[model samples]
Target: MASNGSDPHGPDRPVVGLTTYGERAAYGVWDHDTVLLPSTYPDIVFAAGGIPVLLPPRPQAAAAVDRIDALVLSGGPDIDPQRYGADRHPLTGAARAERDAAEIAMLQRALEREIPVLGVCRGLQMLNVALGGTLVQHLPDAVGHNGHNPTPGKFATTMVDLVPGGRVATAVGTTVAVQCHHHQALDRLADGLVVTARAGDGTVEAVELDERPFVVGVQWHPEQDATDIRLMAALLAATRT
Candidate 1:
C-alpha cells in the first residue's frame, strides 16, 4: 500500500476508489463544473479505516484502475435498461449514457484483474448488468411488493436477512438493518456471483462472488444510516488484501 499520507487508523490503510455521478450545478441557469459525490459515501469508508479516493466519470476507465487498490461503485441514478436488454420504464430517472459506458468498462477491467469491488444500490445493478445479468428496474413491479417504501429517500433505514454462511454474515456476524433509497434491484444475478441477502419481500438485497477477492453488492445504502459499519469495513479490508 502507498504511504503517501499517514493512516488515521495507525496502520497501512487501503486506498479504495469510490465512483460517483456528475451533478450539474443549478446557478442562474449558468453551467458550472461537474460536482463530485454527496460525500456521505466516503465519510463512511473513512470512518471504517480506509482512505476514500473519488473517481470521476471518465472514458479511459481502464487506465484509472491502476491508481487505486480497490473500487467501490456508489449509488446513483437508474441505469439505462437498454444496457441490460430491457425497455425504459416510465418512472426511470435520468440516465447518463457516458457514465454508464465508463462504469461498465471499469467493472469489466476490475473483474478481469481480480480486483476487489463493492457495489451499492445502482452500483449493484451495474455490476449485475456488466456480468451478463438482469435487473428488476422497478422493485414494486418485479418483487410484487413495495421494497423501497420503508426508505423513500436517502438517509432512511430498511431490514435485510443475511444468507447463512454467506460473505455478509461472515463479516457482520448477523443479519441487521441497513440504509436504502433505491427502487430497482437485481432480477437475475450476474455470472459467478451468489445471492447473500434478501428483504422480507424476497427482493435480492445482497450478492457476493464465489471466487476470490472481495466482490459484493448490496441493495441498501450503508453510507446513509451508518448502522451497518461492517459494509464499509469489509470494503476496506478487501482493498488492503
Candidate 2:
C-alpha cells in the first residue's frame, strides 16, 4: 500500500518532518533503494504527541515543509568541510554532499517560515555550518579525551549545564544527563544562535536561536536516552501554539 504520507491524527498533533539517510541500506535480507532513519527519532516525536514523517534527503523534498508544523534534522553523516570554508581535518569523516545540500535547503526554509527545528549531533553541526559556523572536526584532539564519545559505536554519558532561563533550561532544567556519541563539535557558533549549554569540558552541548522560540540544537543524542524527551516535547509544544 502506498502512503500519501498523510496522517489521520495530524490535525491536533502537529506534523514534524524528519530527515533520513538516502543510501543503500540492508536489513533482514532486504536490499534496495531506501531512505532510513533510526526509530528513536519518530518514536520520541510520537511520545511527545507529534506525528512524525520521514523526509527523504532531496532538495525537492524541502517543499514538503509547507505541510508540516516543524522539522527535525536527524543525526547522520558528516558535512562537507568546504561548506564552512575549511580544509579537511586529518580525522574528518567522509562527507555526504547530497544530504548536506538537502537538509541545508530545507533548514533554510524552516527557519524562514519560523518553523520549530531540533537538530541532534551531525544535524547540529550542519546547522552551524549552514549559518557560517565552523567545526572542531576531531573532538579528542580538541578536548584531550574521548569521553564525549568513549566508544566508536556506542553512547556515552556527559553532564551538560544549561543557561539560566534559556530554551533548553526552561524545557529540561539547568542540568541533564545526556547521551552522546560524536567526534565533531561546534567551533565558532553561527550568527543568530546562542549557546545555551555546555559540557563539563566546555564543549558546546546545546544551542537555541536568539530570536526564535523553538529553534534548538543539541550535541547529545537525547532520543537514545529514552528518559528525557524534553527537547522533543518543547518542539511539539511550540507547534501547538
Candidate 3:
C-alpha cells in the first residue's frame, strides 16, 4: 500500500501505528475510563523520530494496516491459550479477547503488506501465537525461575545475549541489559521466523523475520529505558526505505 496522499507524515517522516491496550484505566480525579496505551510507548516512538498514532481496540483499524509505515504491537494481558490450541495453565491470567482479535488481525495484515513491526513483551507472544506457535503458559514451570517478571508490576533488568549476526545484534549489540516484566515466553518458534536472542536461562528473548525488512520481537520491554532506544530507532529507520 502506498503512503496515504492526504496523510500529514508525507514522505519525510513515516507515521508509525502503535497498538494500544483497551481497558478501564483511572487517572487524576477520573475514576475509570477506556484508555489507549501507556504513555511510555508513544513517547519512545516520538523520541525515535516516528509520528506515533495510538491504535485502540477497534477491529476496523486492522484493515488499514497497510496505510501506516510501521506497526508496534504493545505489551498487555495474556493471550488466550485457545489461540494456539492449548488448554489454559492454572497460572495463566485473564485473557483479553478484544485486544487479541484486533492485534492478531493487524499483525497478519501488516505482515502481508510488508510493514515494519516491533513486538515487545506480550507482543512477542502475540506474534508467535498469530503464526501458529505455542507459548509456555506458565514460564516458571518451564524456565524454573520468575526473573522475567519478578514483581507483579515492576520492571526487572535481564541480561540478554543476542544471536551472532542477527538483526537484534545489528540493532542493539551482541548483548544488552533489558527492562522486562512478563511471566510467559515462547515455547515453539514459528515457521518463517528465527530466534535472534535468548536469556541466560535459555528463554527465547528475541526473534526476526528471516527475509523481511525489520519485523522483530523481543520478550523484554525496550520502551522502558534509554539503552533500548536503538531497537526502536532501527524500526523507524526501516520505514523510510
Candidate 4:
C-alpha cells in the first residue's frame, strides 16, 4: 500500500520496513513475484520484539517513511551493477532499480529522523551503495574465496572475525562463525562507516554506521544464522530510544 504522508500508527510499535525482490514476467507472472523471504526474518524480528513491514519498490517513498520507525533491507538478488559503476557479472541476478531507489530513500529518511536500521545480505550492500560506498562485484572471482554468496537455495557456514570493540563484536559478544551466501562484498567501506567484522580471508563481512543509533549491516545472512541474534536485539533497542 502506498503512503499518504502520515504515520499510520502514531509511534507505537517499532515498524521495520524491509525491501522486497523484483521479478520479471515468467509466463504470466515472474518467479520472483512469488519469491518469499525466509520465515526467519519475521520470526527474528518478532523474537526481537519489532513489527515487520515489507517495503515494496515505490516512487512515493517520502510518504512511506512517515509510517515506519525503523528499516531492515532484506536479502535478495545482486544489487544493480550501475550502482557501483561496474559491468554485470554473468552471475548477477534480477536488478530492481525501483527497489534500490525506494530503499535508499527510506535509508535517507531514517537517518534524517534518526531511525534504527539493520541491513542483511543484499540489504547490507544496499546500505553501502546508498552511502557512497562501492561493492566487489564477484567475491570468489575477485577475492579468491570459495563462495561468499552461496547458491540461493542452500546454506553454508563460515567464520567471521570481528575487530575488538567493533559494533558487531559488542553486539554479538564474540568473533564467531556465521552463515554466509553472497558472492559479492563491500570493496570500499562507506564514508563514516566502519568495518566491524570480516571473513578470515579478509573479505569484509559486516559494517556499521557509527553516528547512527543502530545502522548495522552484515554480509552474512543473520536471519538464517543462529549466532547473529545480537544484531536484531541491538536494532530493536534503538527503536525504543
Query: Which candidate should be chosen as best, given lDDT against the real structure?
Result: 2
- Which wins on TM-score, candidate 1 or candidate 2? 2
Clashes of 3: 0
Over 108-211, each residue of candidate 4 has an lDDT whose tens digit, in order, gives: 88788777788898888988998899888878877775665557677678788888876678888556778888788898877988888878788888888987
Residue-level lDDT of model 3, residues 1-241, one tens digit each, is 3243443334556678888877887778876658568788888877766678888777888966877889999998899999999998989988888889999999989998888999999889999999988999988998788888888889999999998888779988988888889888999888888998999999999998889988999999988875457888888777656
Q: Which pairs in model 2 have colliding backbones?
A: none
lDDT (C-alpha) at residue 118 in model 1 = 87
Q: What local distance difference test score does each model get?
A: 0.78, 0.86, 0.85, 0.75
* Model 4 local distance difference test score: 0.75
Stretches > 4 Å off in candidate 2: 1-11
Question: Worst 10-residue stretch by lDDT in candidate 1?
Answer: 1-10
Ranking by TM-score: 2, 3, 1, 4
TM-scores, all models, native as reference: 0.89, 0.93, 0.93, 0.85
Better of 3 and 4 by lDDT: 3
Task: Find the candidate with the highest TM-score and give its number.
Answer: 2
Q: Per-residue CA lDDT of candidate 1, range 187-236, in tens?
A: 87777989888887788888888876689888877787555567688766
Q: Which pairs clash (backbone N, Cα, C closer than 3 Å) in model 1? A: none
Off by over 4 Å in 1: 2-8, 27-33, 150-152
Candidates 1 and 4 compared by TM-score, better number: 1
Total clashes for model 4: 5
RMSD of each: 2.8, 4.0, 3.0, 5.0
**Residue 195 lDDT in candidate 1:** 88
